[model samples]
Target: MKARWIITAVSAALFFGGSLLTSLRDPWFQNLQRPDWLTFEFLIPFIWIFVWACATISAIIVWERSSKRSRPWYLMGIYAAIALLTSIYSPIVVEFRSLIGGLIVGGLATVLVYILAFLVKPISQKASWLFLPYALWGPIGTYLTWLLIQLNPGVS
Candidate 1:
């Protein structure tokens, strides 16, 4: 139990810090011409709050739903998958500046989270809690993607 808590806390911190660092340092991210509606300065804090809140709620849900016997692997797998997919899609979505493409990727990711929630039947309710913020962010991200496409129509 103690180890699980430690792992969760560490993982959450790493994920949050890594995201912040990337946003702060990535040239492509910093140089991109964002739409008027998409403000990075404001979005960063919002994203940080959202990520931490989701992580906390998800950790609680995992503790309540899964046993020590299986929780670590489950949590690790979920977080890893999310990180991998986001890493792959984020740059492409930004670089390509395609509204449809970004929407497809973000939409699929959102759907996958919902699907995972259903698959974990015993914890589906709590899983929904874990993913609700992400789900909400998906549409906002899609909107930003669309705006990016509008702002940089020639990018691809």
Candidate 2:
């Protein structure tokens, strides 16, 4: 349906748009110490694209199948919270250069994604599974962020 597509597009746009607005390029980020295993830096954006697509689709599935009163409020509240929390990552991590802040915000984002996954399950199992990748990846991201913070003590 058109609504589903619209939601997906808008969700994707909001995520990527927020990234554009908040993302910063700095020598600090570039020069930060990373393990040899963490060398695949070029794939970060692509991974985010995939994760957002999955989360968006899952949210749409939940919205379509849930009660009529789920729109622009209950669902939107969760979605908005998720978006806002996610958007907080770059600013705190890059702008303020706060390691603990990044960990906390990233941790919150992970929790929100899990909550989104749970919210979709009452609607569609398949849709719920769509968020699985993100759910699975969130902790990994949080861990890596923590490690990066630990590994690089001089990023600020």
Candidate 3:
């Protein structure tokens, strides 16, 4: 459906564009005592593109599979929550420059993803499964961010 693609496109754009617009490659980021494993800073955008792709596909499936009566609820609840979490992650971490704060909030976001994954499984298993990639990225990135923050403690 035209509307489905439009919804997916808009959500993907907001998730990816909003993240890309965050304070990236700043002087502060450059100076962080990043670990050897964190060397692939250049790979973040690509990773995010992949992650958002999964999310977009999952959104389409979820939207299509939801019953007519429940379609609006899925859009407003799961989709909105996903959008909020995806959009806030970078800004919150960048604003505080603190892994502790990031861990707390990012942890919540990750859990919400799992919750949504479970909620959508009965609607569409593929939709639920698609959340896996997005969920997988969270902990690894959170840990790497933790390492960076711990190694470079000057910032709040």
lDDT of each: 0.58, 0.75, 0.74
* lDDT for residue 4 in candidate 3, whole number 0-100: 77
lDDT for each residue of candidate 1 in 53-88, tens digit (9 for 90 to 100): 674566556656677576646654665565445444
**Top-lDDT structure, candidate number:** 2
TM-score of 3: 0.84
lDDT of 3: 0.74
- RMSD, each candidate, Å? 4.1, 2.3, 2.3
Summing lDDT over every window of 10 consecutive residues in candidate 2, give the lowest-scoring window: 68-77
Clashing pairs in 2: none
lDDT of candidate 2 over 51-86, digit per residue (tens): 877877777777777777655357656776776667
Off by over 4 Å in 3: 72-76
Best by TM-score: 2
> By the lDDT metric, which is better: model 1 or model 3?
3
